[model samples]
Target: MTPFRLGVLVNPLAGLGGSVALKGSDDVAEQALALGAEPKAQQRMLQALSLCRPHFNNIEFKTASGSMGADLLEQLGVTAQVLHQLEPEAVTTADDTTAAAAALLDSGVDLLLFAGGDGTARDICSLLEARGRSDRQVVLGVPAGVKIHSGVYGITPKASGEVVALMAQGELVSSMMAEVRDIDEVAFRQGQVRAKHYGEMRIPEALKFVQAVKMGGQEIKELVLDDICAEFIERMDSDCQYIMGSGSTVAAVMAELGFDNTLLGVDLIDCDGVIASDLTASQLLEQIDHRPTKLVVTLIGGQGHLFGRGNQQLSPQLLRHLGADNIIILATKSKLEALEGRPMISDTGDPELDVALAGWYPIITGYHDEVLYPLQ
Candidate 1:
């Protein structure tokens, strides 16, 4: 079997500055003191290394220096083949990120896996777009920042580890969305919550999903869409597994099914009930294949992304398990109106897969009320 090339990038300063900023302490030491964060970027990198290292005996982990990208790989008992970075004074910003990522993409790696927040993801995504390398090749994200907009992440660092473990096995995964919860930092500092769209990234959306947090000043009803989704899920065949997607809408399926859900996170469900706690693509597929199954999902409130936003746990293998026909979308009239002609955005970064999901899909609003909305 041909070996797959994996690229690793670490923004040692990813959450470093977030601690001082009102965005919450993205800095590990400061976040550890604040008790909200676990100083996770480094730990997450080590975890990904542990998972990826054992699988790729002939593989090389190329990175940048000084915890910027390649340095962290060295700490993980891995060696960096090339050095690409600038002075520390010039390294604090994400500007070096795009150039460094471009360098890796040029190396012809099969995949690139990096650890950082949404800012890092946007830089990489933009770089990939600029280089026209965002197609075919895949990228995975290790959660390490205050906010992650790239749909290419799992619900947690460990879950990200699990994804790399399976992907290294050369398994197929589904494209997912990465949503960086938009927040008005200036207004937030003034004691107001103003959250809006930051950007989107494409990753593998897993059954165990991360729910998009309702940004500041938003009074979103967690139940409106639930009421609608539950009505439809109740009609599903209990013998068939139901691969539920992320969002409060799909959470209603769990509520109606008599199971607990992580309101703003993703969960897996089927005839047996909740399959697992936040599954990546590979995990979901290992459970859903060969069994009659369907997927129940919903669109993002304002952005209206049906797939690949805030749902990185999904892998390509999972999407094939349920097939597109088995997928269900639940949305409220208000949520639909919020889109206002903006096409349902998908940044799973797979152009062919993105086009495959394009078409008019059936959206169930409430019991007995449904509409065919275009996913394009």
Candidate 2:
């Protein structure tokens, strides 16, 4: 079989803002660096390169120079044709990303493997559209950014590698147009999520590896939320501490109990009222220490993600402590149908925890109604 030319690019500073609670690293890379944040995109790209190293002979890698892409591939002992020459600096900008993408496109690569979040995706998407190469070339994203609402990204770095391997072997993988969504960093930092579709790209589809585009909660019904709220109240156990997950759907449940809720942050509640609002990961663990606690959450509409998207406050450690059985999932029928029979996903960065959280879980649809949905 003929070797497939793969273009590799890393944003270098992608996901630098997540650990420091910066929401996104779009224009705040310097702040994240000042806060002692480390570069994760290169490490994640290394993970992908490591997984695909065995098939190196079947793939010809085309990458940017320095910390952008070729450096990581070189560490893995894979020789790649360096396309763009980036200046040696402590930081790289959006221009570097666009230039690398343009050079990769000009090199006639079959697939472009990128490491970053929505902003990086937007940069590449714009380059593809401007060059009119979106239809001819396939793109895949390694999930290394903070705000990744794009459907072009794989669920994880390892998943991205596996999909690339499949394509390199000329496997019968499908392709489709996925949305590239980005949010305002300023608004996102203030805990207000304002995501917009920047563009779309044709990406290789791997059912278990690629992620779905996040859906907006614009089609919400007040009555359905009211019914779900009433249902949850009826089943509340006064003795068990209930931790409310983030999202408008979970916020609705809190509204029914006549308590002020954190619309986009984690809150802990009980039969009495709200115990804590806008708690952190450490605070969540402290509040639920050695006590019988349950978590209430809802799925992202089109994405079908149960965790690791907007609510990173629900740490993997916390999820392991709470266990899957003690968790309650709420979603409207319209939201569930939006998935078109796709299982919900979780990328908590813990493979063991992700596996444990997998399988079918009962999702409360409305008053006295439930459906078994697979959590993958």
Candidate 3:
């Protein structure tokens, strides 16, 4: 039997800055390392590849040399043909990522599995665009970076592996074009978010594993927002801590309460006012303090994801603490209808929590208006 051609690439320095609170690992990899940050891209790659062990004989691996790809495969006792070689003792860079992607494309792999953040996704997507092969090449991203606004990535490392495993088993997984987006690291560090679209790449459409491109901008329904906000504000308890999630729908609620909103990041608020703006995952967990906290979130339009799109700050630990009943979901009726009956997804990177979060819940659509929506 012919084996599935699997191309693998890893950005060795992808998420180094995330642990040390640098916001992103674009050009500040050295500074991140200076802060005692350890490399995690290869470890994340290991998580994905480990799950593919059972189907090893049915898959042919191709990758770049060293930490870029071959090193991790070697560690797993899997042999891969090194199509691109990096200079010995040289630090990996974005150029290396692109060059390695070019080599993989030239080798004609069925799917290219890349482990990195949005920046890495942009490198590979840009190369495909430059070669006019965006439609032809199928790529998948394993989330190992601080900034993961792109839609090409799997919800988690294990989820990405599961998708590849399906292909290895000869399952008919369809492909779809997912957007590639990145935020300016400088602005992000300064507490301002400026996400811009780079391009799109074709990825396996396994909705249970892959996330959707974040819907940007404000909702068009002005009066419906007013009604929704009115209903939410009426129910807001002054004693409870509210974790305001990212997105315009949630921003509308903040605006109604006369509090400053982080349009693309998490914010902490209460009846008193904005407690903190633009918090990291650790900062958010610190502030909860076992207080009666509720999370105000909106689904990613067209995708119907309640968690794990742009709100990674709501880490699984925090979600479990807040409990599922404390979550307040806000979305327009049109947005829910657009899903065409697909259930809302919660790819929180914790399979157990995702299952716990599933069930029917009332979604605030307008004043005294709600529809029972299923979150899976």
Candidate No. with top TM-score: 3
The CA lDDT of each predicted structure is 0.62, 0.83, 0.85
Question: Candidate order by lDDT, highest to lowest?
Answer: 3, 2, 1
lDDT for model 1 comes to 0.62
Q: Over 4 Å off in model 3, which ranges?
A: 207-376
- Candidate 1 lDDT at 223 equals 45
Q: Which tens-of-lDDT digit does each residue in 155-243 have in candidate 1?
A: 77778777766545533333434454534445655777766554554454333212233332335455455557656866778777666
Relative to the true structure, candidate 2 reaches a TM of 0.55
**TM-score comparison, 1 vs 3, better candidate:** 3
- The model with the greatest lDDT is 3
Residue-level lDDT of model 2, residues 23-58, one tens digit each, is 889888999999999999999988877887778997
- Model 2, residue 89: distance off in Å is 2.3
Lowest-lDDT window of 10 residues in candidate 1? Answer: 207-216
Clashes of 3: 0
State the lDDT of candidate 3 residue by residue for 148-242, as single tens digits: 99999999999999988876764435556789999998989899999999999878755332212224344447777888899899989978989
Q: Give the Cα error of residue 276 in candidate 2, in Å.
A: 76
Backbone clash total, candidate 2: 0
